[model samples]
Target: MLAHIHIRNFAIIDEVELELEGGLTVLTGETGAGKSILVDALGLALGDRADAAAVRHGQKRAEIALTVDVGALPAVRDWLAEQMIDEGDECLIRRVIGAEGRSRAFINGQPVPLASLRTLGEQLVDIHGQHAHQSLLRGDEQRRLLDHHGGLEALATDTAQAWQQWQADRRTLEEALGSREERDARLELLRYQVEELEALALAEGELETLETEHRRLAHAEKLAAGVQAALAALYEEEFAAQPVVARQLRQLETLAELDPALASVRDLLKDAEIQLGEAADGLRRYADDADIDPQRVQWADRRLGRIRELARKHRVEEQALHAVLPELTAELEALEALDAKLEHLEQAVERSEQAWRALAEQLSQGRQQAAKSLGGEVTALMQALGMAGGRFEVAINALAPGKARASGLDGVEFLVSANPGQPPRALSRVASGGELSRIALAIQVIAADAGSTPCMVFDEVDAGIGGGVAEIVGRKLRELGERCQVLCVTHVPQVASQGHRHLHVSKSGGRQTRTKIQRLDDTGRVEELARMLGGVEITARTRAHAEEMLGQAAQSAALRRT
Candidate 1:
């Protein structure tokens, strides 16, 4: 419920603070009395688009704030938790619009994006205006309104979930079907590529091994020739150097027998002969083992070249060729299985469509029943609001062949005939602005028990209504207030008299005026009602009449309570 509203430098309202209470509150004023300005300020505080022209003269900015009590509203509590805003018992929405058209919004004293403020405001209050009458003409809105009235939110949610699942399944199936042709071509290409790669029979590290062997074999002839030359120099019969060393060692041994110092030279010569003999033996072994075959070298080179060529063809390094082979094989296998997968997807789609149709049919039946009940309730409400001959109907038609949606398979449109002998037409097309407001009121009153919003605002709902009709409108508004907080702007004394609270708006100076809202006592209310009844003059008869109207309104309210 809206607890308070404060406005500063907004249009003709220079500064005003209004403490509001639950139940019907009416703002009454003469023409050009800034009544609309109050509503405009509230609209801005509720996240409506800001206009620089709304700023009062001599002010740089216009500010509006609304305090809403939401302690008992679970939806609001949950929403606030979700938004991560901190507030106790009440939520305050504030908007400041600069003279340059720049605007900012805040929730509970914490700055917030305008969009967030808008979302929260919608959850808190619903503003009904004459222009909103067009909503009755829309099939979608009608369906939603009816659904809300029927308290079938859970069923609608189930239907929506089922529909989303069905759509997802269908999308999966379509994607599978659409890829068949592409998959077939891909399968063929993968098969050829896999076969080509398999035929190469590439092995890890095989290229490196082949290159090493090729280098060794290419140098084999030169290595063998150098070993042979070293063997001849060390061990060949006539050209042997080791035999000469042996003969010199014998002569040194004979000389050592004559001189002790010469024995050291003989021992050194003996060691040199032993080392030379070992070196010659090593050269012989190396010569015997060296590779000299050109065919082996050519074979190693060809193997390395084949590996390089395969790597180049696959656009990978020679060592990475082996890794590519496995991935290519997997791709081929996947492509080969496309047809089977596609068949499964098609079956899934069929089952999903069937499930969707079943759920949609059930939902359609529920909506049909709900629409009937809703139409009856609204029709009764219309009769009470001075549309005695008005006929209200809910027309439901299928939007799709079999599939359902979040709302239902059927489209709902509200039809009305405001006069006797008149054919029912779309409510938007048949009703005048005043009739539309009353119709909206009726619908809202019927839907109040099912909706979550705690407050409803009607702008000039009493337009084009007076006398007994105005009294009826007032009674209905007061009845609606019993269910939810209602704020109505009206010029009718009867309507104004029905409110639990009354606010008066008037322009004082050329550009300096203010709006004042006060919770009226019984006497003050009567006085205000008298003023509403007799223009600017409050005669004794008018005051008496106003008191009588208040007494009747009280009696009606008491009966409604019973």
Candidate 2:
């Protein structure tokens, strides 16, 4: 239920904060007094498109915020939780529209996209615009209303998803079937590529190893000469380091016997001689073990050439050639299994089609059932709204199989018979403006009652009707409020008097005209009602009439509660 609304610098509204309660609440004022502006501002908070012109003149921006109780609304709570912005039991939605037409929206203090605000808003409030009846003439709107009233929205959504999936799969299968020659060509190419890669049989890291070996063999002679020179300098020559170090070590040893300090130097000379000898031995072994055969050099060159040639052929680096094999092989395997895949996709398409058909059928049945009930209910409401013999019917026509749509296979239209003995005809064809308004009101009331949205806003729902009919319309709304929160923008005194709470919107100031709204007390309601009944004058008779109307409305409400 909507708990509060705070609007500032919105249109003629300078600043107005209202703490709203459950049940019927009405806003009434003179023409251009900005009663409907409040509803529009509420719409802004509920994610309606913003307009720069909606900002008050000379103001930088317009702001509107709404607080609603979500304790009983699991769907709304679930949405908040999914968005990770849940505030226990209450939801706050705010919108700001800059004078430059830029807009920002927020939910639970977290900035959100307009679409997210809209998505969550729908579950919390359902606004019935003053001109809603205009859109009701469209076929799509009629279908949507039927679906919404029937509680088949989820089923319809599932049907649409299934149909889309089936269509997508069909397209895929058709594309595949159309390209058989291309598939055959691709298969041939892939098979040859896979065979070529398999023949190479390259192993991971093997290329690097082969290249190192090839470099070693290609420069073997230079390496062997370098190693022999090193050995001669270290040990092979008679004046090599090993012989020099041995002569030095014996001299140091003789001196160390006379002086202990020279003993350490003698040990160092001996260690150096031993190390030099080991180095010469290592170099000699390397020279002996080195492979310097020309045949091996040619073999290494050929092996590297093959690997590089294949790498260039595949447009890959020699180091990456090994990775391409598995990729090509996998594609070849899949292409070889094309027939199996085709069969599987075909089966998938069939299953999706069946699923869509089943869901559509269920939706159709549900609509049929709901249509009968809704038509009967609306026809009854029309009777109370001064349409004595008017009849309402939901016409369900099946579409041809070739002309299927995602919503369902059935086309929905609202048919009306305004007089007894007249055949029911399309609303647009037979219903007059007044009749349309009444029918629209009846349908809206029924739909709103059936829906789960916690709050309903009806702007001028009693338009085109007056006298006892207006009072009846007001009664219907008040009765609806008994179940949920209701906010109505009304001009008729009969309707205004029926509200459990009344707010009077009045404009003041000359060039800086601002709209102010205040809740009405009993005396205030009577005076306001009298003003509505009387034009620009308040008389004793109008006051008495207004008092009577309020008295009757109060009695009716009391009886309803009982």
Candidate 3:
């Protein structure tokens, strides 16, 4: 329920604050009394598009605020909680439009994007009029209304979940199917590469060890020749250096015995002779061990060249060849198993399609049942709204079989005939502006119990209705208010008299023309009703007639309460 509305510098409304109450509230005034301006302000507060021209002449911006009671709407409370906005029993939506066509929106005084505000507004109130009626002309809206009225939300949710699962399965099948030809081509290449890698039989660290052995063997002849020359110099029989060093050491020992002062020199010569003999023996042993084999060296060099060639051909380091082999082997194995996997995927796709069709059939049945019940209820409401000869029908058609789509496979259309003996035509083609409004009202009334919005606003629902029919319309609006708050903009005296609260919209000229709204008391309401009855000429008879209408409305309201 809308608790209050405040408008400032918006069109003809310079500043107006309307405090609202529950049940039906009616706003009434004469022609050019700026009643429409009040509705426009409410629309802006509900996140309607803003225009720079709406700002007052001297003002930099226009502002509209609507405070709505949302305690009963769990969807709205959850949405606010998700946005991290405060969740109170009441929610305030405010819009400020600058002169430059820029606008800002606030929810509960916290700034938010206009889109968020629009989403929340949609969950709070629904404003119905000619424009709203035009929207109802669509087939989808009719289907949605039917679903809402028939209490089929849970079924629809189940269908949606099933459809989503079906789509996911189908997508997986498509991806697997699309790659079949490419995978076959890749399989042929993988098989050949794997066979080639297997034939090489490369071993880890084999390349490094082979290269080291080849380098050592290649220099063996030069190394052995150098060792033999050193051995000859150290151990030749006639010119043996070890014998000469031994003779010098013996002469130094004899001199040391002759004179003690020569003893230190003799000891040093003895050490030199011992070192020389050890060196000669070591050289002889190295010469004997250094044996060169040309054939073995050549074989090792050729093997190393072959390994390097294989490494280059495979585009890898010699040591990395071992790692590449396993990857190639796995690719070949995957290729071998591809056909079996594809067959399995094909079967899965068929299963998915069958599951989807079964669920779709169930959903279609539910919709058919709901459509019949909804059409009957709406038709009954239309008759009560003075369309006694009208016929209402729902037409459901099936779409082509394929991946599951949103709203299932059925395309629904609403058909109606405004008069007896006329063929029912599509609602969009047969319904006039005023007729559409009434039909929308009927649908809304039927679905009121299912709708979550706590407030409903009707802008001139009595546009083409008058007399007893207008009274019936007022009765219906009052009945609707029993379930949710209803704000109606009407000129009919009977409708105005039925309101639990009455607001009078009037314009006054100051520096600029401005609209104002005031909640009228019982006496004030009578004067306003009289004005609506007699226009500018409010006589005693008109006042008395207004009093009679009020009395009747009060009695009707009391009966409804009972």
Candidate 4:
């Protein structure tokens, strides 16, 4: 339920705060007193499209804040929790529109997209605009009302899900059973590619090892020649350096016997000779083992060329080709099993179609049953609303068998006969403006029984209705209020008198011309009602009449409870 609204700098409304109630509440004002501004402010807080022109002249921005109780609304509570904006028992929505046409919205102090606000707003309230009742004329809204009233919403949802799954299965089957030419071409290419990759049979790191060996073999001749030259210069030649170092070491040893210092010198020379001999032996071994095999180099080149050629064919690097091979093999395997996959998809489609048909049939039956009961209820309500003898009907016709749709396979429209002996016709064709308002009100009263909204805003629902008919509409609205909180903007004295609480909007202040609202006391309400009854003046007779209407309304309300 709407707990409060605070609006500032909106149109001519400089600042106005209101505390709303649960039962029937009415807003009545003069023609230019800015009642519509308040309704527009409420709409803004509920995520309606913003307009910069609605901002007060010379003001920088307009702001609206709405507070609502969500303790009894589990869906709204859950949504707030999902958005991480759940307060203990209340949800506060704030909307701000800048003079430059920019706007921002928030829920419970957390910034949110307008769409989130819209989604949550729908659960909390249903605001019907001027002529919004005309939406009843649309077939889609009619079907939704029927389904909701019939308690077939769940089955309708199931049908949509099943139909989607069935369509997905059909698409899968079509792809699997591709054109014959395309399938044959792909199969041949995959088979050959798989065979070629398997034949290569390369190891993980074999390429790097092979490349090193090839480089070594290709330079073997130069390496062998350098090795033999080093050996000859060291020890393999006729007067090798090792023999000279040996003779010097022997002389030093003989001299060392003569003197102690000479002995240290002889040991150093002997260690050098030993190092030289080891170096000579290592060079000789290398010369004997050096190889210059051209044939092996040619073999290495051929192996590398084959690997590169395969890499180019597959559009991958030589190293990455190994990874690609396994993936291709998997694809080829799937192609080979195409027949089995096709069979499975076809069977899945059939199963989903069967499930969808069963749910659709159930939904259709429920709608048919609900249509009859709803038609009867609405027709009776019309008679009570001053359209005596007017009849309402719900016309349900089946769609063609092959036309698959998310909203079951039936077309629903509202039909009516406004007078005695008149043939029933479509609602739009048979009802005039005033009759349409009554008809729409009658349907809404019945639909309200199944509605989940906690608050209902009927903006000018009494339009094109007056006299006793207007009072009856007020009573019907009050009856709806018993189920949910109601907010009505009315110009009818009869409706205004019926409100459990009333607010009078008046424009004052000369230069600024600001709009203000006040909760009416008993005397204040009488004066306002008298103003509505008479034109610009309130006489004694109008005052008496207004007082009598209030007494009658109060008595009527008291009797309704019992």
- What overall lDDT goes with each candidate model? 0.81, 0.91, 0.80, 0.85
lDDT string for model 1 (440-554, tens) is 7678657764566788888885677789878987887888888889888888898998898787766665445665555677888888789888877889999999999999998
Stretches of candidate 2 above 4 Å error?
Answer: 174-178, 185-332
lDDT of 3 at 427: 92
User: Any runs in candidate 4 off by more than 4 Å, and if so which?
Assistant: 151-181, 188-330, 337-359
Candidate 3: 10-residue stretch with minimal lDDT:
399-408
Candidate 3 clash pair list? none
TM-score of each model, in listed order: 0.75, 0.75, 0.74, 0.73
Clashing residue pairs, backbone N/CA/C < 3 A, model 2: none
Candidate 4 structure, TM-score to reference: 0.73
Order of candidates by lDDT, top first? Answer: 2, 4, 1, 3
Among these predictions, the greatest TM-score belongs to: 1
User: What lDDT score goes with residue 489 in model 4?
Assistant: 90
| Residue 376 local lDDT, model 2 | 98
How accurate locally is residue 504 in candidate 2, as Cα lDDT from 0 to 100? Answer: 91
Residue-level lDDT tens digits of model 4 in 70-180: 898888888888888899788899999999989999999989999988888877877766676689889998888888678677688898898888788878877776674
Error of 2 at 277 (Å): 45
Q: What is the C-alpha RMSD, rounded to one decimal, of candidate 1? A: 5.5
